[model samples]
Target: MPNVIEALQPTLEGAAMRAVFALPQPLRRLIAGPPIRIDDQELALDAQLLLKLQKLTGQTGLSAETAAKARAGMARATKITAGSPVPGVVVAERSIPTDDGDLPARLYRPREVTETGPLLVFYHGGGWVIGDLDSHDDLCRFLAKHAGIRVLSVDYRLAPEYPFPAALDDALAAYHYAVDNAADLGSSSDAIAVGGDSAGGNLAAAVALRTTRAGEQKPVFQLLLYPAVDATRRRRSRELFGNGFLLTDHDMTWFMEQYSPQESTLADPRLSVLLADDHSDLPTAYVVTCGFDPLRDEGEAYAKALSDAGVPVVARRFPDLIHGFANIRPVGHRFEEALFEIVGTVRAALELHKG
Candidate 1:
């Protein structure tokens, strides 16, 4: 990882001062002792959670070497506590058809649809090996309420059981299902958008590309937040931000080890969207990144490549945020701002799709 000094540079003197300054006191000590974030006392709670997990699993402790498969299984369930429900939005459990079987899905819709809006198919982030619909429940609700659109959250099967193509297959299946069943789901917009964080973002991009190739309708927009788009693990971000960050090199390597194809699928562009031959026909996109995140550079590179390919791209780098920050709005105020930004982007994309 970049030395502590370099990584903290952007936020050291400015907006990120809080998260940065706390590093020495709360962050640094936590590495060898215990994690404590001055900005949020709850971080101490996370350290405790790690300690508990470590003890239960019979592992040494919560360190960079924790096994990802165990982590995924341990994180099987994610609960989202609502601050308050948006007046018109309702979150309901549902099913989406896929080639393998009927996959689980959650549908979120604004309370009222005065007119047609946009349909968003969202995937959750958990490095492909972890995460689920429940894990990202808050994000879906916030998007539906704030963006004023119908959001279909897909619960694609994870890796080591389903593996790489399995999640990718489910993602495409869910998108097509949303397209075909939009009316039944009370979706007003004909144009569909797909989004997700981390691994989910990878699936979203893959679905878009696959849809285009299959002659299926493309999503009107793509929203990728700190997406793990490259499976090859050759990027500078992979090397530079490999350690100390919330997401460490070992954790990523473990995730990749669990989710990757058995043989030579690593080179497949579908697996690594960054290596795709062309980004030309893809939908307009909003790529979000956390300044301290290891995946930051590749995401920025993808945005630039998309722009270069003639696709309209909007990139937002939150210097004060960390990876997976969007999943914890209750923990940090920045989460709320990020939610609003996502809503704005979705609304604008829907409007453009209409025109």
Candidate 2:
């Protein structure tokens, strides 16, 4: 016999999330309290409410749980918030063969597009620990439908078990597989893009650098959403917006330790992409950051370095949004609005190429 309150905890939680958006915008704003100002930017009403709700839940950090528990909690959270998969997009489960074994993947496309075109090789964000293909399924579907291109969402190995370089190795392998089997995957080998959010974005940036330095075929574009580009930097954003935000500085530290146990590797360009001496020769990039994110400074720094290196880059920071907003659509108008603008930019940059 479960306690009645405990039995209804999930139901109550889900209802609370819905109730926030169910209210009139004015009332929601009122409950969200005053605008949270930091670094000359105002936090959006929706962000404040979500953070409040998060506080009520008392979920301070995933580091408190084992990696397995953290993953389970993340999956449950996604189920509560991510909503349904967008329709009219076909999804096919794929097994991308890697040196270690077969890597799981999901290929997404508009149901109408049967012919070959450009494709985005995507990675999911979980600080190299929690996220998986299922957690990011709606995100992939949203991108495929809205961006009007194919997306291959790869499930790379997680850390604390398969640590540094394993995920990157799997990422490189998936990209090469897409290139080698472009026809089968319905993508133009020369028009492929590499993209992801957070840790996934880190992998994408690393893949681009690794490929270019090796003189191999590289992605034509990079979609980096609030990426952890500098692992070693102690920036101001971390001090200001580190706690109370969706992602905490302590969480980042714990995640990095689990992923890259070697303190020596923190300075490696592959891990700390901002440490790369030259940002030249990298693919065209769209770097997105939010004013309230712990990774904001590093992401912006990477974008500036890229632009200074003469690479064509579109860097935009949504003044009011928080980190991980890209995948938190279906929760509120603000989240959906921000993601809409982002995919619009992605569509413009990685437009489908008929080849």
Candidate lDDT scores, in order, read 0.72, 0.88
Lowest lDDT 10-residue stretch of candidate 2? 346-355
Q: In lDDT terms, which candidate is top?
A: 2
- Separately for all candidates shown, the number of backbone clashes (residues 3 or more apart, or on different chains) is 2, 0
TM-score for candidate 1, please give it.
0.78
Off by over 4 Å in 1: 1-88, 261-263
For model 2, what is the C-alpha lDDT against the true structure? 0.88
Model 1 weakest lDDT span, ten residues long: 73-82
RMSD (CA, Å), candidate 2 to true, equals 1.9
Pairs that collide, model 2: none
